[model samples]
Target: MAKIVLITGGSSGIGKAIGEYLQTRGYKVYGTSRNPKNYKSSFALLPLDVTSSESIQNCVTQLLDIEKTIDVLINNAGVGITGPIEETPISEIKNAFSTNLYGPIEMTNAVLPAMRKQGYGHIINVTSIAGYMGLPYRGVYSATKAALEITTEAYRMELKQFNVKMTNVAPGDFATNIAAGRYHAPIAQDSPYKEAYGNTLKTMDAHVDAGKDPTKMAEVIFKILQNPNPKVRYKVGAFIQKFSIVLKAILPSKMYEAMLMKHYEL
Candidate 1:
């Protein structure tokens, strides 16, 4: 029997790539989407709304009823939010955290009982490179992913004895449709951050436009699944993006801030 893998947000982007690749590699892959009927996928695409606890329970129950057990859970469903901190709506910030942080947490909780009963499981939280730092105009997005990353660190220890493993895979910009769904606070003419925020948004989009192929992320996931003892965190992206995390560890605070300011031309 092949491993049963459940991936959230698998209808497209990194999640889609991982699901398709894993299926080709002989795993039983199931991806989730809010509107499963709207997207065509090679593997099973089930209906899921990560924000709702009821939706999460239904999706997991539906999958478990068929598969008997879930061998892997990929928390990849996330939304993007970008804007100056002050201008970004509080409601939107909460929504981002709800989707990116609370949703993943709830999903993990939903599967833990089955996983513990089976005595084996792997949970991979798809975070972001942006989570490693507080980027201008993307602070909310950063915070949500960062919280997930830290949460996984704690989960790993608690799940160790149960044979349930959890890790965070933080990817940098990748060519995907994420930009289309991201919330952007309008650039008001009189706002203090309009000019800088507008320029930063363009830069962010251009980076995504020129980002590496999503297949790269898929390959990384495949390698991770093969590992009997995976690391706590893995990062996939350009050298600079990965290195940014390293630099933050070694570089002086002001110096690193200067580098980011220069890169964003803010």
Candidate 2:
């Protein structure tokens, strides 16, 4: 029997790419959207809003009732937020955490029981390269992804004995509609950060515009599924983006900060 795979935020972007690729490879793929009816996908799209616990549980239950076993779950649903941390609204920051961090955590919780019962399962949290380091004007988004990445590390050890696998795949920017949905704290004319924040925001958008294809991320996920003992984390993106993580590790804290500041022209 084919493996049953569920991806949150499967309506579009990286999630959609993964679902399409896995379906071609013979896995049973079902993706979730806030409004499943709004998007048309080759595989199934169920209604899900990761921020809502009720919606998350209902989506999992519905899938379990039909599939009986969920072999893999890709927590690919997330929102992007960019602005100077000091100026970003508290409500927006909370919303970002709710979707990017808590949502995946809750989704994992909802699926674990069935996975434990079956003695098998893999949960892949879709984090970001930004999570590995704080970027100018994207601090909130980075923090949310960073939180998820750390949470996955803890989950891995806890799920080990249960025969459940948990890992994070952090991607650099990919060409997607994420920018369209992302929340931007308007640049205030009188704000001290107006000039620097405006420039950084434009740079960030340009990077996404020039980002690699989403299919690359799908390929990485497919490769991860094939591994019997997958690593705790996987990164997918351009060479420079992936290398940034290494640079951050080897460079002195101050030196790295300088490099980032220079890169962002801040």
Candidate 3:
């Protein structure tokens, strides 16, 4: 029997690449996006909006009603909110958390019972290197990914007995519209962080424009799904990301902060 795999935010970038790649490998792939009509792929398209509980519920319910079982679930729907901490409005911050953190949580909850009954399943959450290390102007986005990373850890432990594996894939920097589509909250002229926000946005745009191919990260994820025992976390993208992870572990707190400030031109 063909395995059924569902991916969220699969209309573009990494998610789309992964869905297409997996479809070629013979998995029965179902991908969700807010605007499914915008993309063409071999996988089936389902309408989904991670920020809305009703949308998430409707997607999952439709899948369960028709498919009966899901062999794998990929929680890849997320948004990037960029701006200095003080300049970012509370509403944008809330929206970021809604899509990045709570969205995955709700989706996982909806699928857990079915997976548990089926006796086998895999859950992959696409986090980011930002989750591992905080970057300038991306505080809220990073916080949301960090929350997902931590939650994945607990989920791995708890779901072990049920034979349901949970994995978190953290890619360094991939060619995606995330940076370009980043939401910038209103900042008052008197805000002290306005200059910092300008510098951070410039840096973000520069780095993202020169990011690695999204297919590279998608390939890593596909390989992980094929593994007999995938690790709790997998890092993809450039070697620099690995080096940064090491540096984060060995360097002093002040040194790490300095490196981030210098590299990001903040």
Shift of residue 134 alpha carbon in model 2, Å: 1.3
Candidate 3, residues 1-266, lDDT tens digits: the string is 88999999988888888988888888889999888898897789999998888998899889989899999999998898887787678999999999999999999988999999999999999998889888787888899999999999999999999999999999877788887677986565887877777777777777788889888877888899999899999888778877898899999989999999988776
Candidate 3 RMSD computed on C-alpha atoms after optimal superposition onto the true structure: 1.4
- Give me the candidate number with maximum lDDT: 1
Local distance difference test scores for all models: 0.96, 0.95, 0.88
Deviation (Å) of 23 in candidate 1: 0.6
Question: Candidate 1 lDDT, tens digit per residue, 62-140?
Answer: 9999989999999999999999999999999999999999999999999999999999999999999999999999999
Q: What is the lDDT of candidate 3?
A: 0.88
Angstrom error at residue 25, model 1: 0.4
Q: Name the runs in model 1 displaced over 4 angstroms.
A: none
Task: Report the candidate with higher lDDT, 1 versus 2.
Answer: 1
Candidate 2's residue-wise lDDT over 42-78, tens digit each? 9999999999999999999999999999999999999
**Each model's backbone clash number:** 0, 0, 0
Worst 10 residues of 2 by lDDT: 198-207
Decreasing lDDT order of the candidates:
1, 2, 3
TM-score of each: 0.99, 0.99, 0.95
Q: Between which residue pairs do clashes occur in model 3?
A: none
As a whole number from 0 to 100, the lDDT of residue 31 in candidate 1 is 98
